[model samples]
Target: MKIFIAGAGAMGSRFGFMLHQAGNEVSLIDGWQDHINAIIENGLEVNYNGQEFNIQIPIYNQKDLDINSKAELIIVFTKAMQLDEMMKDLQPIISKETKILCLLNGLGHEDVIDKYLPAENIYLGNTVWTAGMTGPGKVKLFGTGALELQNIVPGFEKEANEIAEALSSAGLNAKYSDDIKFSVYQKACVNGTMNGLCTLLDGNMNEVGATSTSKTMIWKIMEEFRAVADFENINLDLDYIYDKILEFNDINKLGNHYPSMYQDLIINHRKTEIDYINGAISRKGTKYGIPTPYCDFLTDLIHAKEDLLDAK
Candidate 1:
């Protein structure tokens, strides 16, 4: 597979490194200059399951990418808010035969991708795979997770499954899904609960889940997310989803991993994906005439945090 990982952040780095190690010709493009230069100077250093190693993978910034180059598979890993810009930057590498696998978090991303690429070329999916940034070009990856994917255009199951098989060959644990949108909503529930609360509390998933206050917040947020999802005709098992998110905290699934929002606002002082996550729920809640006070407040709170970072 001639693979190009667009956005190449934590999860993108993980996928590109894994696929490249599996003998696929993989290249990467990212907006972060620090990360790009780090990888260019010294291969991406990955610490997986307690073993640390490096793979000399080719990476480039948007300015440096070769426009005439083409890709067989282009996996989008951009933050929800960054998708439009990323897709535009990645356009030159996309050909008619290009299969775009978007494992980005949050709802309503396929619509955005649709604007930039052919609908038939798009693959909508989600993953439980988690990775954390340790430095500019280094990441810590642990635990086991699977990739579940589906073709955005209906009646393309065989084509979607072929991509899954290719990813599975690289140990991505890929599976073709008949209902990936459902999986995506389910995954969003996990993110909405853990990412917001964990970031606000400045704690790891375990640390936050240990608090009664956090549990109460999780319930409120899930209920609001449930109502909004229900309006969209996505039926999520509320109790199962809530408990599943907490299970990561209870057992240290990510092992003291502070959710990405925390790293973005607090550590790097960058903006977050709040507008697409909880903020998206709040917007839909408004459209459906359902009250999502909890989500609304959290969205405001995250924005305030962002403002505070900027002020500092």
Candidate 2:
């Protein structure tokens, strides 16, 4: 598959490396100048599962990319806030046959994507794969993860399965799901709990889990998420989801890792996806007449943190 990964940040770069290693023709498009130049001059420095190596993959800033170069598949990894801008930038490369696989965190992204592409062309999915960036063009990928995605429109199961197979060929552990919406909500629960709370607490998953009332606090927030999901008719197993969130506290899993929001707000001093995660739930709650105090409070707190840090 000729693939172009939009927003080549930590997760994007990891996917680029893995797909390229699998002999698929892969290129990266990112807005970060230093990251683009670093890969073009040297290579993408990667530490995969504690094994360090370098690979020369083609990378470009979105503006510098050749507009005529079409893509068979474009995996979107942009921040939720930047998805529209990314779709606009990649428009020239998106042909009718191009399949867009969006694995971004949070909710309501498909609405944004719908403006640019037909429903059949959009694939919505989520992953538990974790990645971190050390600096421009360098990323650390740890732990194991799986992907669940589905075409928004039905009757494309064969095409969706083919895309899944291609991703699985690259060690992405991909599966074509019939209920990707449910999977997305499930994944959002992880981000909503970990990303906002961890960033506010200034701690990793382990620290949040180690807190005396971690479970109770997390449950409060997730219940809000569930209420919002219920309004949308997305059934979520609170017990199952709660147990999965608790597993993040284990050091052997993703306990030591700081989530993407933490890296954005604290480490890089940039804006976060709080609006898409907890804030999304809060907004939906308002629309559906459901009270989501915990989500609303967390959303406000994360924005306050961003303001305090002067985050852009």
Q: What's the CA error at residue 55 for candidate 1, in Å?
A: 1.2
* TM-score of every candidate: 0.97, 0.98
What tens-digit string does per-residue lDDT give for candidate 2 at 33-110?
988999888899999988998999988788766766799999999899989988988988988999999999999899
116 in model 2: Cα distance from truth in Å? Answer: 0.9
Clashing pairs in 1: none
- Candidate 1 TM-score versus the reference: 0.97
Name the candidate that leads on lDDT: 2
Candidates' RMSD to native: 1.4, 0.9
User: Which of the numbered candidates is closest to the native, going by highest TM-score?
Assistant: 2
Model 1 weakest lDDT span, ten residues long: 246-255
- lDDT (Cα, 0-100) at 275 in candidate 1: 87
Clashes of 2: 0
Task: Give the per-residue lDDT of model 1 (tens digit) for 37-155.
Answer: 89989989999989989989988887666756799999999888889988888878878899899998888998988888789999998998888888899988888889999998888
